[model samples]
Target: MATYKKRGYKPKKEKVVEEAIEETFDESQSDVAKAFDGLDEAANKSEQWIEKNSRPLFYGLVAIAGLILAYLLYTKFIAEPTEIEASNELAYPRTFFDQAETAAGVKADSLYTLGLEGGDGKYGFLDIASTFSGTKAGNIANYYAGISYLKMKNYKEAIEYLSKFSSDDELLGPTALGAIGDAFADINQPKDALDYYEKAANKQANDFTTPLFLFKAGQTAMQLNEFSKAESLFTQIKDNYATTQIGRNIDKYINSAKYAQ
Candidate 1:
């Protein structure tokens, strides 16, 4: 009994368990390495894309910044200054006109002429209108010019200046339209007068100017021998605008229109 017994084979369960543990450890290491490699590849692709497209993106950003800067400069420096200048320039003409309203005969006419033509080298309504056609003061100049020309009995000039004037002013807008109709009537263009008179009546729908224009329209329609149209206009004054100055005397015109019809 001198020699040690020879070693025997291990149990099957123990051998299988040890081999599975070794295999699992090896596979886990391989999966981790593959995941790290994928991450490195994605990072490289992102860097390449950024490098390729960076120039255009930078240029686009610069363009947007420049546009914003230019807009700010124009608004502050050019647009605002021009608007202020236009407003200031209107004072000379407006003052001359105010004085002309109270002046009598030759002096009144002279003041109006000065307002239209400018005095002492100062700008007049006509000059302002031509210089600052896009501004509020310039637009008002056209209205003033129109009325001045109307008072001067220059019907063509009245039409020219009035047609150029535009505003949302509640009183002036209707007045300009009615004045145009008056010019047409003075020129013996009854059809044109009637059309503009009707426009004035409907434009702002106020008590004062509406009845006045309606009266003018009725008169123009009668001049055109359109008795039916005249009758309707007078009836409108009687029914809806019976309190105005024109409405007070509207009954006779209504009766006249009815007789003509």
Candidate 2:
């Protein structure tokens, strides 16, 4: 028979196991504490930075607000009042332009001269155009100056002022465009004249100005020996604007172009 041996716990090995577990738990606790400390330092630094920079950012915003207020005040108090004053001075020139439109030759010349000289006088049109370019009167002055120059046969000056005169009114817009065509025609640039005349004709597309400019365009094309283009323009006017004077005469223009060809 074999005798059974008794199993016994080893005190030294148990103590060594307990010590290893204690050491591992201590290291884990230390690592957790170190992580928490690092997070606290980062939060403190971020707060410090925000505290240091907030005042400058706030002042910068205030400065921008002040500048905006200053600009608004300047425009309202200074620029707008000056523009109003200048607009009041344009009445004389406008009246003269209306007069010149109805009159002819000598009468027209006198009216235009008055307009031009008055525009340069104490309550001059130039003063309004220069000082109150934001006003309707200023824009009209540019138109008046351009038309006056055109009447004087100063094509270059006419082009300059006409180019400056902008309008949304359909009649005036087409009229200005037509005047440019007239100027180009006067300068003997037939091809350029044809282009501008076509532009004027097509600009607003009304019965009054459209057929008239189209007729002028056709004539210009005929002068430039562009028979096909002249024929096309005259045909368009005849087909689309038959009741108009130019449209009624368009057939004659077509016949002339065909004969020329």
Candidate 3:
């Protein structure tokens, strides 16, 4: 038996493998090309949309800029100048108010009247409070007017002006509240007096106003026959404000409230 060999024979398996690798490379190239085409289409759409809305975008930006400019102009020209003018106007009334605090009886009353009503072509606290309503000096005018009314024994007007005044100041805020309490007490409203005294005490925790108002609140509570509340307030003074003059003398008040209870 004999076997015959054919010359120049090539394997078809290697050719099939080479053809598959070429096909895979072509498919990868096609995918990359499709991705680039998609990106280009998206960019063209974005540019078209921006072009269509460009006028509206520009107008919106311009409107925003206009508002900012208006605010700046108003703050610089109108508001700042008004504030300065209001402050200058407040000085005249303030002098009368300060002098009234130290003067006696008729002299004090005359100064207070001058402070409230104005003289020598200058504005008074009442006018400043009304005319410059939103200014800092105007706010201070309200406080001055309220105290003037209180000193003049005009309890109703005192309550009105003091109630209108608002502040977050450590000293002034509590003092205003305490002054309201004083007005209420003078008008024979012990309950309202106690309430405002409590408010004043809790408005801000400081050495001067806190113990002062707390002592007043305790006394007012005693007047209303709220002995337990009075005792509690006195106890707070003892615990927190022992260095204060009122706090040093708080024990007697505490004992009185407890005994009453």
Candidate 4:
């Protein structure tokens, strides 16, 4: 049997399937076009917002740049020069202070005075502390001045200067705190002495300052009739710092504190 067919003819089912595929493609293309239109609209809005805010953004950037420049200039010119000058000025006073530490009687007092008051047109610790307050040298001047006052038995001034000074140095920081405690103890403020002594003991735990301050705190606590705290601190010295000088006698302190309780 011979099947008759027209030219370029397809089956009915094939024609129907092709028509559906073309319609689906048209719908997918329409969806893609809609998505592109939505993206373009959003991009236009972002551009408009950026354009509206461009002047403020530029000024903000300029402000940040100006702050950076100002900081650099200050560090290079004012801060660096002041630090150098303060260090130079500190040398003169430090010499007298060192001499005073080894001297005795009226000579020691005179040297300390010179250290505080300055000579030969050089600035003293006091002057450096006031003039270059933000500099490292100036900050150390406060520590020196405080120690001088402490050695001079000027307890009030010692406390004042020591309180003004701060440091993160393991030795210096704890030493300064302990010095303040010494001042408080000399002034008969047992509570304040105990407080500062404890702070010094805990500031940075080490072999030297830690046991030293702990012993002082224990002694201060004993004075305050805080027998338990005193006993605990003394025990810490006996346990941890047993090789140190104060540690050798810490057992007696612990016994005394325990008996007092």
Residue-level lDDT tens digits of model 3 in 34-144: 999999999999999999999999999999999999999999999999999999999999999999999989999999999999998999999999999999999989999
Q: What is the descending TM-score order?
A: 4, 3, 1, 2
Which 10-residue window of candidate 3 scores lowest in summed lDDT? 3-12
Candidate 2 backbone collisions, by pair = 119-124, 119-125
Candidate 3 clash pair list: none
Q: What is the per-residue lDDT of model 2 for residues 1-261, given as tens digits with 9 covering 90 to 100? A: 998656774578898999999999999999999999999999999999989999998999999999999999988998787667766677777788788989998889888767766844545555556767877778877888889989978899888888888886779988998898899899988777788789888888789988989899998988888998899999989889999877776788899998888
What shift in Å separates residue 35 of candidate 4 from its native position after superposition? 5.9
Return the candidate ranking by lDDT, descending. Answer: 3, 4, 1, 2
Top candidate on TM-score is 4
TM-score of 3: 0.83
lDDT (C-alpha) at residue 133 in model 1: 88
Candidate 1 ranges beyond 4 A from true positions:
1-69
lDDT of 1 by residue, 33-141 (tens): 9999999999999989989999998999999999999999998998789879988988988887899899878888888888998888789999999998888888889
- How high is each candidate's TM-score? 0.74, 0.69, 0.83, 0.87
Computed on alpha carbons, the lDDT of every model, listed in order, comes to: 0.90, 0.84, 0.95, 0.94
- Ten residues in sequence with the least summed lDDT for candidate 1: 1-10
Query: How much is 149 displaced in model 2, in angstroms?
Result: 1.5
Supply the global lDDT for candidate 4.
0.94
lDDT of candidate 3 vs native?
Answer: 0.95
Candidate 3, which segments miss by more than 4 Å at Cα?
Answer: 1-49
Q: Residue 23 CA error for candidate 2 (Å)?
A: 34
lDDT score, candidate 4, position 231:
98
